[model samples]
Target: MTKEISFIDLGLSEEILNALNDLGFTKPSPIQAECIPLLLEGNDVLGMAQTGSGKTAAFSIPFLMNIDVNLKAPQLLVLAPTRELAIQVADACAEYSKYVKGVKVLALYGGQRYDVQLRALKQGPQIVVGTPGRLLDHLNRKTLDLSNLKGLVLDEADEMLRMGFIDDVESIMATIPEEHQTALFSATMPAPIRRITKRFMHNPKEVQIKGTKQTAPDIDQSYWLVRGMRKNEAIVRFLEAEDFDAAIIFVRTKTATLEVAEVLEKHGYSCAALNGDMTQQLREQTLDRLRNGRLDILIATDVAARGLDVERISLVINYDITLDSESYVHRIGRTGRAGRAGRAILFVDSRERRLLKNIEQTIKKPIPEVALPSKELLEKRRLAKFTQQVQQQLESADLEQYQTLLEQIQAESGTDLETIATALLRLAQRDRPLILPPDPVFKPAREYRDRDGRNGERRLRGDNRESPKRRERRDVGEMDMYRIEIGKENGVEVRHIVGAIANEADISSRYIGNIKLYETYSTVELPKGMPKDILKHFERVRVLNQPMKMSLVAGKSSEGKRGRKSNQPESDDKGFAKKRGRPTAPKF
Candidate 1:
């Protein structure tokens, strides 16, 4: 039988080893064990590993060891796909090099003020981590100097490719010194990544960690089909009935993290939000509080919660469904760690049923659909908890003073002891009543089963009649028609409109209604009362290389406007419509 390798056997420096010990890392993971030695030997390595495979440390440790802190130039550069991931990688590198003197790390990404990055760059940080677009921007502005680079790491290469940053990646790589060592890590290797490795690396060593994509067997997962209630209300009901030590609630956006955290805190849960917008110090403080049991629920996005391992997290709630199956697996993997049993609950919207099926196929297991806790069940649980509190107070608390006061009150008021006790209970539970209130009534969305016994919903086509039930449930009357300047003439299709709206607005396709395509413009029906910020964001969203200059139509419906050829202007020889007097834009 072979023995496992410890961090001590990896031949690391004392400072590095001390930092590892402080972090409580006794043994290296499989990828780390294999890549650390090769990386330290000045070799270009290609590693295949999933998100939580410790690949960050595998490359970080060797890069830190190889850099000469005396020369305060950029020696190690890591390019991640998202701002959240770049910040996480920088945080990890900073932790690993805490004991080493004169070593600094800086993360540069969009949404952060450029002045902050400029000041950090002036400080001569030896390590730089950033997204490819921001990195290219810096390179173009001559703000970053990589003349003496020693090592380069492409973290989550597949994700970078999927996000259309491969061109920016190749452009950045072209400027770097050819003699520098390279380490590329990804979950999957597509053709573009393979081509780059062949062109840039010099006889690279390959390391593949098997089974990283598999979900933990100890996790019991289920989904609650969002029907009759809003997501936040359903979450509160679930928490009222569930018995969990600690949990992490995953959302899709930074704004959502704050919103969900606020809702949970209002319900008297000890929770906090972790997102990329927060400073490094604030993020660390939030995490420390969670670890010390001061907080029980953490609301976060996927990137914010990456590589998080907490033993007390016995539950995970997916407040917003992930776009891909790999992320779904990673979200639930936060729980059920160290062989402890964990429970994961997913909140699925009606429009997301197809995504749910994709997740089931990836895991090769069925996630049973569950209903929200019944009002009766919640009432019983609350009463039981109140009773338990009373029992504990009676057994351990000193009640001699209170008992005398109670007797005096009873004697003066001429009330029985039972009546006084009941009155006191009412006073004690006034802020949080023991009895559950009536749940809000909402009409359930209908679903149609296809020939294959699969549940699905039809998308709104041009002028398709909607059933009265669906119309009332979805509030079709509240939707307003808006015109965009892309249509069949620009090679735009129905799927393009749906995909753009769904991805960019964080809105489900079900909410989008009739889409009519014309020669130069198209109109779509969207729920009214959209926030000004969301409207502003949509203007920047492009479809088929053209901005969706979206504007509200003059009337509520586009029924008559579609066939009004007399009101439409003619097109020029260049296939462009001539300018004409437009209707007054409506107020939001």
Candidate 2:
């Protein structure tokens, strides 16, 4: 066998090594071992590795070691595809450069206030990490400077392409000095990404690490179909019934991390939220607590939980399903480490079956569908836990004084000892009862048969037998027609529109009515009198990287048809309506 290479073998700086040692990373991963030496030598490196393969450290250590603390005008720029990943990269870089003083790192992304970023930019940080769009916006506003840049790294290049930010990336790269070093990392080298490497990189060294497709065999994976109850309620019920030492609940957004953690805390769970907004010290302290068994549940976003290893984490709950299979694997991989058996439970909504299917295909195994924990099981577990607590108190505590007081009270009230004990038990459990209320009965949506005579049980679509034109002409009873700005030209399908609306709006597929596709845009039927806030929210919901700028069609007549002919475009032989200008109606 080949000798194992440590971080020292890669010639990283003492400061970086010290930080890595503190972070519990002794040996470099395959990618890190191969790329760090080249990066330190000022080579343009193109790396191909799967997610969670230590790509951040492969580029970060060398980059941190090369930073010039004297010139704090963005010596290095790292571009990520999303805000979460941007913050995550900045956090990792900050951690690696902790010992290397005077190296300021700032994360710039959307959703954060402009004044906050403006103030940070004014500080002249040596390292800048941001999404392509937000970075470009700052560049346009002249708030960011990269004149003294030494290198630029693109994290998740392929994801940037998929999210329609390749142009912005190219623009940002153009603004950087041509002689600076460039490093690009991606899971797959697609055509566009390869073109970028050719245009931007100079004789880049290619490092490809072939990853083994394997999940822990000790992990028992399953999913719960989210139907009748809210996800927070479901999580509380599951915790009450299931036996687990500790768990990490994964959510999608930073806001959701706080929201879910708050709900669990209200239910008396010893949990905390981990997200991008937390300080480095706070994040490390939170993880330390988790490692030592002080925290039982951790509500976190995907980026916040990167590189998280805890032996006590016996379970992982996907409170919100992940967008990709690789993330699903990584999330579940948090458990079942060190030859320990673990459990992974995914919560699947009705509209997220396609995402579930994608994960199944990737893992090459079907995650069995399960119902939520029943009331009987929850009550049984609660009673057992209460009894165990009482037993522990009886065995460990000195209750003689309490027993004498109870006897005196019994004598004064002329009641038996049994009655007094029962009354005290009632008082003790007044806030939290030993029995749970019955859950609402879940009614699954109706499944329609496809044209192939197969039951499309989990598909979020209407009848497959009807043509688009026929379905479009059907009377949309109690539903309103709205046009969304994405169609055949953007490679949007009926299911894409349906899934986007249903998943984003948290509405049932049955409530979404007929859909008509055109070249540039499409019209979807939705329930009438939808909240304005929901309509405004849909304006930002993306389908196939295109935003659904949804707007209500003007002037609906009694026959469920557009009152004005201008709003309805005539259909051709292929059932695709001809392109038209913007609708005359006002936006929601």
Candidate 3:
């Protein structure tokens, strides 16, 4: 039997090893252990590993040691599919090269001013990480010099291909010096990628790390199809309904971590944000609190949550799904450790269904679709918890002083002891409402007919046609009418509008009612109390590859201008009544 190798055994330089120790990395992941030695030997290498298999460290460490700080002019170039991934890769390289002085690492990508990238380029950074499109842009501008480059890396090669940047990637690769060492890392080796390796790489050493793509078998995985409900509200319901000792909710960006954590805390949840922007001290403190139970939720980005091992983290929520399928495995890997049962829940909108399908296929498992918990279910769970807590207090509490006080109050007020006790209970529970009021905007939830007219799972009633009288009576209250620019001419079906609104606004489809499509525009009726930010976000949503151009229709006259009563079935411009029950968007 062979033994596993540690990071120290990979024969890394003292400075690199010291930085690794500071970062608390005692061992290497399989890909890291395999590639580091070959990369150090000055050979072209190709690494195939899942997203979180430590691929960044595998390539970064060896290249960091080999780069010459004195002759710095973009010595090592890393190409990524997106700006986010580019920033992450650059950050990893910078951290690994902390003790190795005079080696500057810069990230160049779109959405930022060219002056910023140009300034960094003039500073003569030894390593550059950027997306294919932006890198080519810099190359064309002559701001970035590839003349002194020593090595090149194509990170997430498959992702770049999927994003239609393969041509740009090939062009950039052709511009780099042919004598430089090259490495390509991707989760999958498609035919194009294989051809690239054969053409550009010279006898490349292939290191394939397998079996890390699947999460723990004990982890129960499921997804919640978010419609018109706010993500925070849905998350709060989950926290209220589920029994979890600890949880980690994953978001896409650093800003999202703080934003989500703030919302959760405002709703009275014990949560903290973990992101790359935090100081090491703050990060350690947040993790310590999570470990000691002072924090119940740790909202984090993918990079911040790397190497996090907390046994009590029995729940993982993918609040914002990542584009990378391997990241899904990494996120859920936080739970179900050490032979313990765990749960992972993903939130997906209707548009991102394709990403969801890719993840399921990559992991080779079907994630069951779980319905959102009803308001009744959440209230029941809260009451049951309150009861358990009261029972525990009664069994162990020292009540002599309270009993005496209750007797004194009873005598003074001539009230029964039970009445005084009930008054005290109400005071204690007054801060948080025990029961949530029903929302009239939403139709009563029950078995809803899918667009196919089959009895599918519960759907919002707005998707179904209501008689004119029923709609007029049901929509009598404060309902706002909004108009969207896309209509029948652009394949603007009713299901498309409902699915987009429900998914984007995090609202349930049932709350969205009375969709009327015309030759050039469509009108939708929703509750009047919509949040401003949600309204703004809804406008930017694209339906059928066209911006919705959603705006308030303004006044009751606009509804009459459309010439449709609340109960009237939707019709085309020619006044042909559409089908009452329309099918929904096709599921991936």
TM-score per candidate: 0.49, 0.50, 0.52
Residues 2-111, model 3: lDDT tens digits: 25877888888899987776554666767788888899999899998866567788898999988898886889999977665676687679778989888888887765
lDDT (tens digit, per residue) of candidate 1 on 1-588:
214888899899989887765544557878889999999999999999866567888999999998798998899999988765676688679778989999988888765446557766877889999988888989999999999999999998998888778898999999998889999999899999999999999999999986434754568899998765557768998887788889999887787888888888888999999886788899889888888899899998876786788888989999888744667888898888877888999998655665686578667778998888988888788788889999998897688888999989999999999998898888888646777666544434445333110001112222112123232213233455577888776767676787677545544455676777888878876765555555666775656545698886633422232322224333222332322222222222
Q: Is candidate 2 or candidate 3 better by lDDT?
A: 2
Displacement of residue 582 (Cα, Å) in model 1 is 50
Tens-place lDDT digits, model 2, residues 1-588: 225898888777899887876554667778888899899888999999866667888898888888899886999999987655676687678878979988888888765556657766776789999888889999999888888889999998998887778898999999988779888999898999999999999999999986648654568999997765567667998887767888999987777788788888898889999987789999999999988888999998876887889889889999988744667888999988888788999998655665686678667778898788888887687788789999998897679988888878988999988888888877878657765565543235444233111111122243231124322232334445688988786666786676667556554454566678888889876655665646776886656535699987732323324432334433342553332222222111
- lDDT of the structure predicted as candidate 3: 0.75
Off by over 4 Å in 3: 1-3, 18-24, 70-72, 187-195, 213-218, 222-241, 244-341, 345-362, 365-382, 388-407, 413-423, 426-588
Best candidate according to TM-score: 3
Candidate 2 CA-lDDT value: 0.76
Instruction: Please report, in order, the local distance difference test score of every candidate based on alpha carbons.
Output: 0.76, 0.76, 0.75
> Candidate 1: where is the Cα deviation over 4 Å?
1-3, 213-218, 222-380, 385-409, 416-419, 426-588
